[model samples]
Structures are given as C-alpha cells and as structure tokens.
Target chain A: MPRTALILFAHGARDPEWAEPMRRVCAAVREQAPELRVELAFLESIKPDLRACVESLIAECWERILVVPMFIARGGHLKRDVPLLLEELRQRHPQTCFELAPAIGEAEPIVQAMARHALALASR
Target chain B: MPRTALILFAHGARDPEWAEPMRRVCAAVREQAPELRVELAFLESIKPDLRACVESLIAECWERILVVPMFIARGGHLKRDVPLLLEELRQRHPQTCFELAPAIGEAEPIVQAMARHALALASR
Candidate 1:
C-alpha cells in the first residue's frame, strides 16, 4: 500500500533550541497517527529544506504528502516564498503528487491547545 | 507613578535553539508596545522561572503585570504547574498584582501567523 506522509515544516533557527518544540509537536502528531509517516523540515537557518524533504518523501513512494507549517504567523516566508518553492518543485517532479495543508497554527487543535495553555495560566 | 509589564513565557529547552523564537516574539511585542517593559522567562530547562519574572516585575514597581505563556499546548506545565506556582507567588507577594492572560497561542495573531506560513508553503 502507498504511504501517506505528513511533513511538519518549521521556521528553522540557528539557535538549535528552537527546534525542540517543533520536534515535540511532530512526535505528538505521530503518537496520534501512528500509521502515518511523519517527518520534520525547515525553511531557513538549517539543512533539509522543503525540497529535500519532498524528495525523500517521493523516494518513500508516498502517494500523498501533507506539508504542515509549524509557524505562528504568515509574514514573509509563508506569504510569498514557500508557495513559490512548492510550485517550482511540483513542476520539476511531475511524477510525485503533493498536497500542502495550512500551517499547523490554523488548525483548531492548535487553537484548542493554546486555549488549554491559557486556562492553565489563569488558574495559576 | 506605575507601569505595565508584559512577561513572555516559554517552555525552555536545554537545546538553546528553542528560545530564539520566544525572544523574537517578545521583541516583536516590544516593537508593538515600545513603551511597555517586555521580558522573557522560561518554565523549565533554564533559569529565571515564572516566579522570578513576577518578582522582577514587582521590583520594577509595576502596578499591573501581564504574564503571557508562549506555549502552544495546555498539557502539563501550563495546565497544572504554572497556576500552582502563581498562587504560591501571589500568597507570598500580596503587594504585587498580576493579570495572567491566555497563552500567546490562543491569540488570533498567532493563528494568522500560522495561516500565513501555510499559505507560503502552498504558494511554493
């Protein structure tokens, strides 16, 4: 059976510490969806860019890949750059199909998670 | 004379890279609220815990302090530990007044940020 892969994309940081939560989030997603193949990639300040991630997914023969951005806001990178890159990749690799989902920030689960964090703060 | 302070809190990591975004967000908040005193504090894997942050605010003689959690989820620390700590601090420092707002994750700006990231990915 063809695999469905989830690529958790983060805004890469040179600091190195910034990546842990993103990794943790990817881990949580895997825990929730054990059968799905989940991976982590970054936009800047690190290796394994989106194209590299996509190529690896293609090698794995994932029929459908969901790229979820682990970003807080769509300022410059998301609004302009990411799409341009994805489009170029799609044109280059016609054999591989890709589906890009909204950043994880837009997901309701994330919002709920934030709310839970808030409530925890308030009760304190 | 009195002032209002914004405390940006994160679940700090030993990795060091995780803290950059929190610092960036705090910087952004400072840029937006230039007059306000914005500070960064961590929950674990670091020094200057939440209580220390609050104490600093008190030392600065701020009349009102806002504690904003930088966490994405309300799992363990935010949900249980933070509130317990805050309560202990409040009991100790009756003179200081604190307003614990929801985590930054719950804010609409964060969601918008995530969406923007997703849009960037799609356009790529």
Candidate 2:
C-alpha cells in the first residue's frame, strides 16, 4: 500500500497572522484524517515553498500527494503559477503521483458556507 | 431606518474567470437574503475597487455597509491595506457607517468546509 499525503497550498503573506486560517484548516483536516500525513506550503513570503514541501514528502516515500490550493479564487496564482510548479514537480518526481485539487473557493460547500457567514454578519 | 449593503471584497486577478467563485458566493448570499443588497468589489486587477463600490453605495443612500474580505487569511492586504481603504472611506462618508468582518477563512464554518473539501479530494 502506498502512503498518501495532502498539502494545503496557500498564497503566503508578509504578516505572520495571515497563515492562521490555513493553519486552522490544516489542523481540522489532520483531526479528520489521522492516517494521512498533512502539511502546509506557500507560494511566496512563507516557509516551505511547494517544491521544498513536495521534495520532503517524496523523500519520505509518500506515493501519492494531493495539493489543495487554499485560495478564494482560481486567480493567476492558481491558473498560471500552480500548474507550472506542478509540472516541474512531476518532472522531478516521476514515481510519486501529484494531484491538484480545485481552489477551495470553487467548492460548493465552501461557497455556501461563505454565504452563510456573510448573511450572519449582515444580519448583526 | 437606513438601508444596508454587503460588499464581498476580494483580491481580483488578471484572469476574468477567477471571479467565478466569488460571483457564486455573491449569488448564493443574494438567494439566501433577498432583502439585503449585495455587491462585489475587488482589491485590484478588476473593476469596481473597494473605494468605488463604497462610494456607489453611499450615493445610493445606504446607511450601513458591511465589507467582507473574501480571503483565505489576514495577509498584509487585509491587515494593512483593507483598514487603510476603510479609513479613507470613513473619512469621505461619515454619514455611512462601515463594518469589517473577518476574512472568510477565519470563519469556523468556512474553515471546516475547506477541511471537508480537502478530505474528500484526498480520499479520491
């Protein structure tokens, strides 16, 4: 059986506080799926860029890796940069399978949840 | 009683399709809360920047406006840029009150939703 890992990739920010929400999501995922190894990575201004994070997982003999973009939209970072990074990762780690998920904002449940949050705030 | 509006403020991208998810969220909010007026605004690379959106609302005689940053985290843009924008808006429209909500990612429900989405994708 191959070991699988999930990486919550996000757009990094200069303020350290910026990573809090993604960290919360990562923690929640870890709590839900204890068997799988989970990690966080960033595009810029943060530690463990995607390449480095993937390399670390590859070294750990993880056979399958899922990269989930923790973004509100599939902007330039997701559409142009992420795919390019994934292509490079594929070339480097041919044996390890890398799968990219759609941006979290694109998920229906997430969108609905956001709408609920907005409604709650608006009502207050 | 003064009319209230909800502004879904997001970081716009060069690619127009990137706005789809935000649009969906906006539509869902509209569907759920038909009485409240909702609008979408961007930080950059798109039309109707935050200033313009708020100005339009002020002109429309909206008394209270809620600006929700549809970001995954409280990055530099949120911590520094957003406040500055809000301050300027406040100075210009003292009659119209403005309130800022936590980024969508900070909301517990939104975070849990992202985690669930990640788990589903990782399992597949």
Candidate 3:
C-alpha cells in the first residue's frame, strides 16, 4: 500500500504565534492517525510554503496527499492561490494523487464548534 | 437585565460565497442562543463592518456584547486590527461591555473538529 500524508494549509502571519493553532490541529490529527504522516504549511511569512511542504512529502514517497485548508472561509486565497499552486505541483508530479478538502470552516462540525465556543464565551 | 448580543466577526472576501461559512456559524449561534441577538460583521468586502455591527447592537440596548473573531489564527489582523477596532468601539460606547473572545481557531474544540475532518478526508 502506498503511503498517505496530510497537510494542514494555513495563512501565515508575521507573528510567530500565529501558527500555534494550526500546529495544535496538526498535532491532534497526528495523534488520531498515527499511521498517516501529517504536516502543516503556510501561504506566507512562514517556513515551508505549500510547494516546499508538498515537495518534501513527495520525496518521502507519499503517493496520496490530502490538503486541508485551515482557513475559516473560501476566500480568494482558497479559490485562486491554492488551485494555482496545486496545479503546478500536479504538473511537477503527475503520478501523485493530490486531493483538496473544503476549508475547515466549511465543515459542519467545525462551524458548530465555533458556535458552541461563542455561546460559552458570551455566557461567561 | 440588559440585552446580550454576539457578533461573529470575519475577514470578508470579494466573492459573496466566501461568507457562507461565517453565515452558517452565525445561524448556528443564533439557533443555539435564541434569546441572544446574533449578527455577522466583516472586516471588508461585506456589509456591516465591525463598528457598524456593534453600533447597531448598542442602539438596540445590548449592554453586553461579545465579538467572536471567526478567523482561524492569531494573525496581524486578529492581534492588531481587532483590538484597535474594539478599543475604538469601547471608547465610543462607554457603557457597553465589548468582550472579544479568542480567535475561533484558538478554541480547543474547533481545533479538534478540524483535526477530525482532516483525518476523515485523508482516510477517504
């Protein structure tokens, strides 16, 4: 069976702490799926841009790669930059299967979770 | 008791559909807290900027307001822009208490939900 990897893609910031939540999510996924390799990549102001991260994974012999955008919404970055970068990677490595998941915010449980958190915070 | 309101604050996009997820989250919050007034506010490219949303809520006699940053991480926008905006709002409405919650991504449950979704997608 070919190895599979997961990349939590996020919008980086100048603040080093900006990536903490993404790292936490990546850690959680890593804990849940020990068999699958999980990593985090950023769009800017951070190390290991999407291309570099994917290239590293490809070098590691990951045949199947899933990119989960850590963004809260399907903004221009998701609609334009992500596809453009992915297409380039696809052309570079046609044999690898790369799948893009919906923005994390678009997921029902994620949305509901935010709602619950908001309620709890407001109540407090 | 003074009225309470929740504002789901987000970074808006030029694409109308980009706000769908934020709307879903606002809907979920509204459903979960029927008694509390809930509204959606955007940083740009959408209606009801944070100031306007908070101003409207204040006009409605909501003395207690919670601004939930729907952003995924603590970027410059969250760390700098949000605080500046909130401080201005606070100065404008001295009686109202404007509480700013941590970025939704910083919430543990939200992070976990993203991790779960990522695992499910990677497995699929």
* DockQ for each numbered candidate: 0.08, 0.86, 0.85
When candidate 3 is compared with the true two-chain complex, its DockQ is 0.85
Query: Which one wins on lDDT?
Result: 2
Cα lDDT tens digits for candidate 1, A1-124: 3356767787776666556566565555555556667788888876688889999888877776777877643435666688888889789777666676754644554444443444334334
For each candidate, give the TM-score of chain B.
0.87, 0.94, 0.94
- Deviating ranges (above 4 Å) for candidate 3: none
Order of candidate numbers by lDDT, starting with the best: 2, 3, 1
- Residue A40, model 2: lDDT of 98
lDDT of each: 0.65, 0.90, 0.88
Question: How many clashing pairs per prediction, in order?
Answer: 23, 0, 0
**Model 1, residue B117: displacement in angstroms?**
16
**B1-124 per-residue lDDT for model 1 (tens digits):** 3466767777776656545555555555555556667787887876678888888788878876668877543445666688888888778777777766654644555544444443334334
Better-scoring candidate (DockQ), 2 or 3:
2
Per-residue alpha-carbon lDDT of candidate 2 for residues A14-120, written as tens digits (9 for 90 to 100):
77788898999999998999887999999988999999999999999999999999988887778778899899999988999888988889988898999999988
- Backbone clashes (count) for model 2: 0
* Better structure of 1 and 2 per DockQ: 2
Q: Write the per-residue lDDT of candidate 3 for residues B36-109, one digit (tens) a residue.
A: 78899999999989998888888888889988898888778887888998898889889998888888898898
Per-residue error (Å), model 3, residue B28:
1.3
